[model samples]
Target: MILLRNLVFALFFGIGSVVIVGLAPVSALFGQRAMIRHATAWTRFHHQLVRWVLGIRVAVEGERPSGPALYAAKHQAMWETLELQMRLDGAAMVLKRELADIPVWGWAALRYGAIPVDREASAAALRQMIKDARRARAQGRSVLIFPEGTRVAPGETPPLKPGFAGLYGALDMPCVPVATDSGRCWPRKGLKRPGVITLRYGAAVPPGLPRRDAEALIHAGINALERRA
Candidate 1:
């Protein structure tokens, strides 16, 4: 039954994704707001798929960050990726460059104002990310980044990547650290389990702090999600 359920979701996800991406040209004709709306709608649809098909419920704890801010979050599974739109409307996510290279999906992501980074992790890449992130803020879209760069298992704890700190310092906006236990139900790989996924938003770490201090705060906050679970 689990395998059948997973397959059903996988098929729906693939087709639905392509359909959403195919709307890129039409969304462009209407402008940024249209693109953002389409992106948010797509995410909401995904939320329904997991809830109804896969039986995974979602709940958000603590306060939702508002206005222009940088959201540093824990990376658990693909679930949290889609769940971001639920937390923040029209969120400009920090993603990998490879995802931007896809056919229609990549183009739609660019139109939606997502910030893509190189996996090679160079000095120039970091600089470009900061530039794009600042531009996203100027456009009035909030930013969401996975401080760990990649997803990890529920109990495993990893150091927050340096790109997070660079963006925090360069953007100079209040950083809101988010933690989630989605991986317990939606693992980074393998079988899917059914349970409630909780996203906890911590207090904002305001700007003007030293790099080390900011990094420490984000790291501790994100890892705290695991401890709570």
Candidate 2:
């Protein structure tokens, strides 16, 4: 049954991506704001369609910080990627450079204003990321990133990567730590279970803290969710 649900969802996901991205140019003609709104609609559609089709409810706790803040979230599953956009009104996401290289999907992400970071080339990529992140901040959007760089299983806690701190210090924005248990249901691979996934946003970590201090604080904040789980 779970496999059947996932297969159906995958079908809709593919068709939806092609349709939305195909019509993206029409939105781009109006300008960046329109493009983001159009792209955001696609994300919201997926968020809703999942609940209606698969019965997976997304329960979000804590209010998202407004303005140009940095959101460092726990990477558990792909669900939070689009769900975060719905939560933050099409915020800019820091993703792998390869994702932006894909044909149609990549073009839409670039036009929609996602920050792509090259994980392999650490220094140069971080520099370019900060530059692009600042550009996104100037556009009045929040910066969303997974501090661990990749998704982890429910009980595993990985240290926050250097790029997260680099962006935190470089951008000099208030850092908001977020945690979620989407992996418990929608994992990185295999069957996805139908259940309510909780996304909890913790208090904001003030900017200008020492790297060690900020890392310690953010790690604790994100790990708190696992403790509760």
Candidate with top lDDT is 2
lDDT of 1 at 34: 93
Q: Report the number of clashing residue pairs per model.
A: 0, 0
Indicate the residue-level lDDT of 41 in model 2.
91
lDDT of 1 by residue, 1-229 (tens): 8888899999998899888878777987899889988888888889999999999998877886558889998888988888786558877899999999998788888988889999877999999999999999898878999988998888778888889989998887899989889888888678887789888888889998999999998888877778765
TM for every model, in the order presented, reads: 0.95, 0.95
Tens-place lDDT digits, model 2, residues 1-229 = 8788888988998898889988988888888789889978988889877897777997778876667799999989888898888787788999999999998778878888999988784788889999999999888889999999998999889998888989899888999999998888887878888999988888899999999999999998777779866
Which residue runs of candidate 1 sit more than 4 Å off their true CA positions? none
Residue range with the least summed lDDT across 10 consecutive positions in model 1: 220-229
Candidate 1 residue pairs that clash:
none
Query: Which residue pairs in candidate 2 collide?
Result: none
